[model samples]
Target: MGHTTGGPDSAKRRLRRELLAVRNALPADDLREAAAALARHALDLPELAGASTVAAYVSVGGEPGTLALLEALRARGVRVLLPALLPDDDLDWGAYEGEGSLARVRHGGRMALFEPSGERLGPDAVTDADVVLLPGLAVDARGMRLGRGGGSYDRVLARLARSGSRASLVVLLYDGEVVERVPEEPHDAPVHAVVTPSGVRRFS
Candidate 1:
């Protein structure tokens, strides 16, 4: 048999499982309060403060909450764009109107996600964002983010690069999710900053 349990890929998988277990163990009340605090800290970032448009996602299950941040941006007159998962795992964009505008969608055998229910703005819409908030399980000291392994955001990053977008990329996570290091691949790109319930950390 060939070896399949080594290298950065396997390390990422192991770390993701461990992080998820801790997240899932959190109390509902704790998660709710963390969500509120996460929003407050994220809104204070200069990257989001003067942004005309933001591309973000609706957190699901044990992931760090983003609904509060979404509403705050909308109220600030920032055009909030939420992702709609495509069959190919690519993401399409849509305007986030509010709580009423999101539809719960289940992608194949994956968990149900709250996505925008309005008109599809196409994937290219993300290029217009001044900031893009990524949902991640963890961020390392070097600002490498560990995503859900859906490859959706990878495509988004590629698109941004192809289009020469200057959008500041940020990740939202719990305080404990900020660790000393996370496994990284050659294609992986480091984020500009991370927003946790406790505060924000930026990388050069």
Candidate 2:
């Protein structure tokens, strides 16, 4: 039998501890350099090259590398879509034209940058995306992601799977955060690729 009796709170605590430990273990310089290298590799990927529309997340905490990657993609004329967190477990896609194009939108206690003409769509919006960049605490060799205990990306990817969409799911992590395997549940969504500052890793 599996260890299934733990509640959400317990699971969240464990996940947080693991993430903190991983972050602390990484060297600061190595982490930053790796992030830059990964961003370069991601941009060079054939699937991402010349892609018009891409879906990405706002990096919080130690995930600052995403900001640089977003800037680069915008400079290259890729239409970037950022997640606008909404109530009732819904998400809206907002175009990130550039830094100056962002307008404040309130969600819970925080404000997110959004574009005026962005389309407010449901989970099905993943199907329309050419690529999806995911944020996670840790990722495994097989592309399993350990998020902040929220099922947001999982639910969106599930919808894409059901619709037979071809969007690539890419998870970004610090190099040390990539592990052999992570504790996963049935509902956990597997990513198509794992990217670190070192390189782009294709999971088996």
Candidate 3:
């Protein structure tokens, strides 16, 4: 008998299992209330309020609320850019004008909403952005994030680092998803802060 080798698929299964367990454990009503509070706090933050352009992720799976926050940001005249998954597995950002510009992209067993536009931005775009909200399965108090086994955000954040920009990395999560630690790899990028349904927490 031979032991099964744990490769990419195995890692993905582990991540999927963890996320599923966390989602199942989340308190539905409390999470919703916390999401509303977090949205209010994010909107009122000086960084978010003053930002001319912001990059935010399109949440998938059972992640907590973000639609309301995105709408609120748009209403405040902030230029919102969303990540569009490209064929090469890199992200191409596009302007999010409103609900009118949204189109469907199939992903993760269902369709994901995306904004498709020819406009593309580089790492300097991060320097220009005052705030950027990152998507994650789990985030720790020290700012380390555990993503869905994909290296997309890590690659993008690395580009920002090479450009010497200090854009805020805000990870949106459900309240309990904020934990003491998460399994991390060498290439993983750290977040600056975390936003839960309750409020925003700054991590060192």
Candidate 4:
């Protein structure tokens, strides 16, 4: 099992590099504005309008910001659950109380992540959510999400399926991140919808 340098893995890695470079180059003001717009559009989704619990993640570095949406969901009385990366790359869940409730955590040499400072509800907690907000680098016209290759979210999706959870799987990205196609693998799953700064696109 040596390192792979071809096929879907290579294709996905190349695309991720290209996308991350663009995201990392964005001005702070533009990122902030995009975050605000993303919040507005995501809040309007019918799937979220009546949701009582949502599984979401905090953005870090070049990722699309989710703090505004997380706050808005909390304000609307939705119980928002955030992920804390587990040692095996599985995610444990915790509630998002507010801005002050997050703790900065660095896993190995990776970027510091903003995670919940409250009680951990275990990985299966995500199955209880009515909606699951996924973080991705890009998504294609067919709803295939291009993830960062961490496999954490892939486990989450599998867990949801095993639990028979009907949570709407959604990804947030910039409008340009929605492209014509993305490299897909057998384990990759299509999302229900994607919320960009400009609008929301539904796949199923």
Candidate 5:
């Protein structure tokens, strides 16, 4: 829940379902192609180029792939922090070493997730990141993100706010996921930009 689905959140609930259907309906081949294109566009972002640490998550199901970009970031000597979902829907961070550094974890009612297995750096680890790559169904011109309704990333964003972190918030999505407007609430914090298969759009 990237600042989503709790405050003025009902409208987003319907919108999330609609956007999710469109994303989940893509052909296997199209999903693959979009992942590659998305990686290409994302890797070119200036925010990521010189970032020492980035908080990111693995792409699962119909979500746009981030494996390529993860590998590229690791190869650049960047510190990549991935989230391990907690029972309370909050997140704990861990350093992503490589493909071998990940372990498969399955939470009840959730698909298996590939998480960093070495050590747990605590939830506050995200505050130290230079950029935080968020997962979302859609991003509006206002940079408001519609999350998966779990509220995991919502806690992440809230934690960052409490600590007054300066990390650049970014969302990775498919080309069509960028939209005109999205429901927003008091808890919603606008993202800095969005990266898609087509290109990157920054918001003030």
Candidate 6:
């Protein structure tokens, strides 16, 4: 009934709508529990093990929470870099000090985002990360991630590619967000793994 096919863009649009519905339908209590479970599972990721610096983002809306994970990584002495949205939809990086180090910023007519308030490093700083945590709406069996229509992370991926970064790219999502398939384009690159509250999935 919804966009079943047509082209990649249409397919993505339909999937986004469907996933958002599922995400927004989560109960507050359930979301809180999921957040804690997500941190526990994500902390067990091999990609994050022994990493000195990890690039991450703050979860907003009903997105799988990363605040706990960030704190855990910091406590482990991992340098956590968070993304700060720029006017051109690219990201600027900043160090995560703690929970109080974040600031809520509303860009134009968009919903507010929790961003690091520390000194900003240029977007290229992400290239130095040993691991990069990505936020997504869905990830397929092949490791391709379906993000919100914003195209922000698309630029981040492009930047990493252009720099020849070897950082392990990981996506944090709820268990149900992992799917059998997702629409993709030629520019789409597979992630190394996906971490859900239930467990972790890796691709070859």
Top lDDT model = 4
Q: Write the per-residue lDDT of candidate 5 for residues 109-145, one digit (tens) a residue.
A: 7899999998999999999999999999999999999
lDDT of each: 0.94, 0.73, 0.74, 0.96, 0.91, 0.92
**What C-alpha lDDT does candidate 3 achieve relative to the native structure?**
0.74
TM-score of every model versus the real structure: 0.97, 0.80, 0.82, 0.97, 0.94, 0.96
Tens digits of lDDT, candidate 6, 57-113: 889889998888999999999999999999999999999999999999999999999
Please list the Cα RMSD from the true structure of every candidate, rounded to 1 decimal place: 2.3, 3.8, 3.8, 3.1, 4.2, 1.5
- Candidate 3's displacement at residue 196, Å, is 0.4
Better of 3 and 5 by TM-score: 5
Between prediction 1 and prediction 2, the one with superior TM-score is 1
- For residues 1-204, write the lDDT of model 4, one tens digit per residue: 878579998899899999999999999999999999999999999999989999999999978899999999999999999999999999999999999999999999989999999999999999999999999999998999999999999999999999999999999999999999999999888999999999999996
Model 5 gets an lDDT of: 0.91
Per residue, candidate 3 scores C-alpha lDDT tens digits across 56-162 of 86555467667678889999899888887766556778777776666668766545656545467643455566788888877877898877656677777877788
Clashes of each: 0, 2, 2, 0, 1, 0
lDDT of 2 by residue, 1-204 (tens): 676667545665687697877676667686677667877878877778857888887665456367678888888888788886657655666777666655666666643434334556655665788888887888877788887655677667777789888888888887777887777877777888877777778865
Clashing residue pairs, candidate 2?
A: 34-197, 35-197
After best superposition, candidate 2 residue 108: deviation in angstroms?
3.4
- Angstrom error of the Cα, residue 5, model 2: value is 7.3
Better of 1 and 6 by lDDT: 1
